[model samples]
Target: MPTPSLPHKPITVSIVSHGQLSLIQPLLGQLDRWCTDSIEKVVLTINIPETDLLGGMRWSFPVERIENPAPKGFGANHNAAFTRCATPWFLVLNPDIRLDGDVLAPLILQAGADSGLLTPRILEPGKSAPEAHRALITPVEILTRNRPGYAAPSVPSWIPGLFMLFRSATYAQIHGFDERFFMYGEDFDICARTQLAGWKLEVAEKLLARHEAQRASHASRRHLYWHVTSLLKVWTSRAFWRYVLQHGGR
Candidate 1:
């Protein structure tokens, strides 16, 4: 086996594959073409082997494939990859997301003195600009944000997991995503934890990427179970109460 070279970039990129070779495969091509100089390593993790992850991968960095026999939850899958990541910063990217521009350079610059949780503006399937980044989750605000005419809060409360960049040390300190959350709320859970620990939750509004988001929770029973359970766990936690108090305008 020939050893592929790694990029000189400081970010370790990871993707948790639920056997979606069709989606992930194309994203790898996009990364290879658009962001060759921006990522140090690419780790593809899966619980099943429906497809060879590196079958046609031709990225600038080394591509790693790890398959776990047992069922792997979303957080657990990424946490497993994080163990092997060797970069100052790490990125969690969904297979359907396509990187088109110099996304990481801007994030790396914005993450300067403070390295918290950094994210970029994501262009959904069809929209003018990207959707607004939201405020922290709260019981009342949750209802309000969904109400007919409520306004989006000024600051970013949480970043979507579609493309999250974390400072390696900060992630280690927060202990990464709480695997307790099988999926869904883990994104908000980690960002909330980072904020409580005094790390800034940054949004690189100037940076851009495309997400062909598959909102599968409502489409499948297993995913729905993980979704609802994670919501219950996060909303009922003591940390959630603290978040509500500090950021809830209470």
Candidate 2:
């Protein structure tokens, strides 16, 4: 991918929140400071009803809150919000993530470099480093951690979706994320689509974000079940098999 000069327009940041009002407030503050006038808009898609807590919030950037009554899956909600985004680039962030200014600079730099799809190094909250080199969206990686006898492969076949930056034009061309995938596989699906479309995906090693993993998702068995089912769906997809073969799957 050819590196393009930074566009004059601000990048839009979109976040999908279920019931994480407490965590999101602070995350928004951090984004306001780091983003400043560079944030074209901050849109939050909430499954819960609109409330005073949302109203009282103010940031250095413009923020918009949209109420999603049907409560579709993560990918669907993001795709729905993308329909309203007008920026040249858009970032999809989880509500529970805590980001630093230094991390944001590198990510934006990388995004400007590729102008396709960019992902940041995600760390477990409070951890000094990343949880792993890469994450494979397969049962093997999920079922076991890297150990003496059972070491998960360091390089993943797919990129995790927790924090992804996308070129709005390319995303629109590919129809954004596949709404069919309620959660897990959407990241892989998008990466696969980008690859198939001859676009490049880059990892911003210098940028980092701390994720409070699955606090809300683990609250219910249904979420876990959906995540598992979604993984299975990806494994069965023809595109996934092609991805595996092209990447020399284990």
Among these predictions, the greatest TM-score belongs to: 1
Which lDDT tens digits does candidate 1 get at residues 1-250?
8744333688889898887878888888887787768778899887776857566547677888888888788889899999998888889889889877667767776575576888888899888888776776666766787678787866778877898889898999989989888888889888888888888988877788888989898799988998788889988876677777877642
For each candidate, what is the lDDT?
Answer: 0.82, 0.74
Off by over 4 Å in 1: 1-7, 139-147
Q: Which regions of candidate 2 deviate over 4 angstroms?
A: 1-5, 112-115, 149-156, 216-219
TM-score of 1: 0.91
Cα-lDDT of candidate 1: 0.82
Candidate that scores best on lDDT: 1
Backbone clashes in model 2: 0
CA lDDT, candidate 1, residue 33 = 80
* Lowest lDDT block of 10, candidate 2: 149-158
Candidate 1 weakest ten by summed lDDT: 1-10
